[model samples]
Target: MFFRFLFAVPVIALFCLPASAGQYDAQFRQFLKSDVAPAARQAGVSQATLDRELKGLTPDTSLPGLVGPGGKGKPPKINFQAEFKSPARYFRDSQFNALVPRGRSLMKQHASALSRIEAKYGVPRRIILAIWARESGYGSAKIPYDAIRVLATQAFMGQRPEFFKGELIAGLKILQNGDVSRTGMKSSWGGAMGQPQFLPSSFLKYAVDFDGDGKRNIWSSDVDTMASIAHYLSAHGWVKGRDWGYEVFLPENVSCTREGPDNRQAISAFVREGVRRVSGKPFPANEVNQPGNILLPAGRYGPAFIATENFYVIKDYNESDAYALFVGHLADRYGSNKGFAGKWKPMKETTRGAVRNLQQRLEGLGHDVGGADGLIGFKTRRSIGRDQEKNGFFATCWVG
Candidate 1:
């Protein structure tokens, strides 16, 4: 179910196989009493809360990405031979077509609440709506797991147990605070709880009660859900008036290898280099002096952009350039509903293993492939473009 949540973003964990409960039930319960209980106590969770929440709890081995009871090994890899994708396919027009109309209607229905959120957080209504639309289909997507159960199981055996341990404690604290009932505190398998899909830690830090019902019911209240999303983005530094990014035409002489956040310069610097908005409009005067970077997700093979810090702010929500782009572009669609002006030229679909191999090879050649993690991040794409330029081939800045 958590894997299903990423349909609108990076598919981070691809564990499709159901987990089966093994022989560790007794030891897992021991772990909760000795390891988790003290932490929850220190975090101000009551004994009653712990007694009620942990009773009858057993490890849900059917959940994906868990290790053995000792939690010493890496979680098993997603079964290999699953299809890998090109970044181009991530921007399919059909995905946008299905979502835009639904999002527009939600905007009108939640218009008043959205206005208050923007005024409070300085994040615009459309951006907030886009995040809500993506996270849980404007609160319609069914979240299928109990948050405490999911967090406890992951803390017991899932990958990154220490991180989940902290989140597990936070979930206990959420229960102690009376925000939601045991049944209502639902989550995706990864423990991103409720409509905004916040991890328990995030829920504790940023989830807000906008409707003033004396409880923050992000699970069913549209107002709380919208406010929470805006709060997360604003806390991560969403710029008030700036758009996330703009599609632009990068002139031939301007190097594609300049694409990344580390290489940011004033937008005017790009204008001087002949990068123009595809709309032929001048760069906004306020934007010209601010920092931006060249963004070519599929290199020269697809749309180009001059992305602002706000774009990176979206990435803070989920650390993928593609994820942020989907949110930003989808937000734009609720207004005029147009697709990218640049086309995604067809390319071979390659696996993460292949991409990691290419990254390793690039590293051997004295290039920074951004640690060879098997994702074609901006660094990897630019490194590929640099290599292509050295070979006297036109740099597509992509895996051709």
Candidate 2:
């Protein structure tokens, strides 16, 4: 009876374990076979490749923001009470200071290759270096997940599985392309692959074999990575011999409400309106008659700029005004190493819920709050400036 009790205890413990832990394993395999295989095969993936890669594949439930099968598992609401930082926090000097030396070193190290890429692609070596530093910390950032697994899991259960489904097929095609082995194709949890962090589709379209190797290996080749980034920017219309934009002193007479890509005026026109480069130099002679739009990122409360069309091209790399500015500013610092001339005014920390409430109020008043997504975009900033102007007050265009 003592021996029987011991065996029974072990059996009971085994039965008590959570079934949900590997609950999706069978379902995930079936999904790969039934759902993914047809599309991947149609995209020229072979039977052996599918059978090899899909074997024992299981969804990684631990990945953040997953929704379950058929939407039965409701996604958790975003924690709106989380602290929302001012845009100024993103431009901290310490961040730029740390990146400068490393970028300049890479510029010298890869000078020959970067020179070639620039002659071919028309993107500056510094801009390429800044993007490289920002994206992967010059390839030091740990990208630890398997690209195949990440694409597979996200396709199965992540918030945008349909979009990931397409990327998953693209990823398999990349595998079929023989550029990198499955083991070597490391990625972020979101499946942005390799040092330049090209999505699998971007890899197919823009990745280049700069080293003259048969394969476009962005994973371990500095030449391929740098060239690939240049190619992407160039394809997206990076104009040669142009800086992204210039920081400027916006006089009080120039209304902050005039901020946006749509409100463009010639550099000469801006100079006529009393906008001066923060550097106190004249706007570049070549750009004087060229169009520029006012970019008041923190509204009138922060440093302002007259951004050129090249600034929007950088925005194509990452769709945020702050992101483009960081890349461009960092690129400039490699030459001069100076921080922004204007100050980011001190502001109290507020919750995203509070910001969302403000956006909702703006929306109710028929202002475009850029979808009330709790994050402030240019639309929200301009609407605030317009409202402030309508109320017969100086328009700060930023949150109080």
Candidate 3:
């Protein structure tokens, strides 16, 4: 549900509808009067608020990934020809280096408040800081769009119109509550509001008034922003006193096919099977008996990790392995600025269509690659490895 606003790696070039030129203004008003106002009223928004806010509102056709009035055109295309970078480039040391110092400074600056947040929420401050940096560059990124306008536009014209319609209603409710003025409620073009990049529904559920300002002002309050992120993670099952994951050395005999959260075993089981921390240290005593699963983000081409359940909790914030790994690794870097122990080998450039083709082949042979979404999630990675094993080759868990 969370979409990273400022720190996304552009894998697909999005297409926007041409500028509205007021072409859909009449339809948009009809939609508000007929479809939205009733729902907003059900959700406790007043008729006066609707009249004052939505009057003369035109759909913002210039937002990215638009697909006409009802997703009528071919849904936005994945730029199948876009460049695909290897994990080495994606997790370059320089990227972390650029973010670490500021993160460290912020960590110290907010030490007392962070201690209280951890005490109350059981999420580490570093994790909250890392997510903050990733979501909006620790509140440095500009969020310029009006949240209601963006949500209303998406509900009227963008892909997943019904979903955005719900968010639009939530945005109106936020306004009706007077949490923020409509003019001050800024958001990304995608309608992820404020520094933590929460959607309107998420803001309603998780935003808090941490600075005692009597309003959950995520737009300008760092305390509110950090606390809100911690609250979201905690609500999604952030395990107390546990870390996300650790980089590890996987022996050659350890098949990469043994990947994914579904294949979880005790951390000690992986250790007994010859996994070792890349730091040459033992797993924490508390963690040794806890469940973890192998995470091979780049199969055998990049770093290996034994990810704790807490790792998946981070994934709930953004459902991407790379995004979770980036947050986890950056959180770790707030204290120790080390890079990965296992190097990411260079990969041949491939496209989403190529990956989809490979997934289809694996699926035909009775492997589930998580719906052939053209992304190399754990299911796809392990499916590749399993196919290699079936062909009597070493399973690198990577695309050949």
Candidate 4:
């Protein structure tokens, strides 16, 4: 299971309107009236609702897209030295530290809401708070694009129409409910909205008015936002009191692999396969019996983690291993652990191109590293590390 912060267009670009603003706005308005309205009507949205939501809306041409002017070129191929050496590659310690106080404050402020959610849903308040802090910086950050325009653009662009179309309808429903003004319904370019950064469909399904003011106002309502996050996690199988899994030390000569949940042997089977507990802290036998899959996100240079059901539950919020690890680690920190026992090996900067090359090279050698997408995800990183060990390149197999 992958988990990480939901992807966002860089916050800096959020306010930068596109150069073709007028033309795109005109085109978008026409598209909405001609296409989106019809689609919404077909989806059971009332004409009155559609009229209120779609009228006066304009396209945000500033949103990032593949091959667009603002799009960066594909990231460089993986090279162990460059990624580690680059100052920008790793998470900034200072930034993370700064976020802690704010995170703690929000945790306290929303303590009651969190406690109530935990009692109802069986997910920890700290974990929910961690997600809240990470997603929108405790509700201070603004989502800069109009939800409808972004969804319409993504749907019309045809990359993920089936998914975005559903999101669009849900967004219209949000507007129809009068919970937010159409003008105030700004969202991430990918269509995630408000503090918990939910896509419209997710908001519709999980958002709640915890304060009971009769609106699920995720944008400005702290109670509603935090509760919505808890609800989402609960719906996704978050088990209260169960650790999301711990860091482990691999024994020598172990056949360590990053397998997906479906392909993984039972936790008992893997325990018998010689996986050993590395945390030094003892766990209950039942907890050990819970199935997990290993993930080496930053190749072998970074720490490895065994993801549990709760990890996948976090992934239901976002689908990146880096993201899941961050949330899990943050949760661990907020709950009282500093970090993993093993230290990440130092390496150079890893560019998108290098990551793609690493995947291509690994796949060519008969290891399925998923596609040669520039993202150096767990599968690709693990395959590379294993291959590196086999080839005597380096046991750590740090990537750049």
Top candidate, metric lDDT: 3
* Runs in model 1 lying further than 4 Å from the true structure: 1-22, 79-84
Give the deviation of candidate 2 from the true structure as CA RMSD. Answer: 9.6
lDDT of 1 by residue, 1-400 (tens): 1234222132445553354455678888899999999988988889999999999898887777677655676656643243344555667788888889888887888888888889999998888888887789888898989889889888888877899899999999998899999999999988999888899889988999999999999999989988999989999898898989999999999989999999999999899999999888898888999999999877887889999999999888877777788889999888888889888776666766778899999999999978888778888999999999999998888876
Cα lDDT over the full model 3: 0.87
Clashes of each: 2, 0, 0, 29
Candidate 2 lDDT by residue in tens digits, 217-281: 88899999999999999999998988899999999999888888888989999999899998989
How far out, in Å, is residue 371 in model 4? 1.7
lDDT of 4 by residue, 1-400 (tens): 1122222101122233335546656655666777777878998799998877667766555555422211332322223333324222334445566667777777787777778888988888778877887788887886888788787766544346556667888888888787788777778777888888888888888999889899889888988888898889988888776767667665544444444564454566556656656656545576776677765554455555566778878877777655666677777776554645666555565555666787888888998777887665556656766787788765443463
Return the clash pairs for model 2, or none: none
lDDT of all predictions: 0.84, 0.82, 0.87, 0.67
Predicted structure 2: lDDT: 0.82
User: By TM-score, is 3 or 4 better?
Assistant: 3
When sorted by lDDT, best at the front, the candidate numbers are 3, 1, 2, 4
Which RMSD does model 3 reach against the true structure? 1.7
Tens-digit lDDT string for candidate 3 (1-400): 4554211233546677776388888888888889999999998989988888888787888888888776566677656554455766668899899999999999889999998888989999999999999888999999999888999998888888899999999998888888889889999998999999999999999999888888998999999999999999999999999999999999988899999899999999999999999999999999999999999888898899999999999999988888899999999998889998888888767877788899998899999899887778889989999889988999988877
Please tell me which model should have the higher TM-score, number 1 or number 4. 1
Q: Which stretch of 10 consecutive residues in model 3 shows the poorest summed lDDT?
A: 1-10
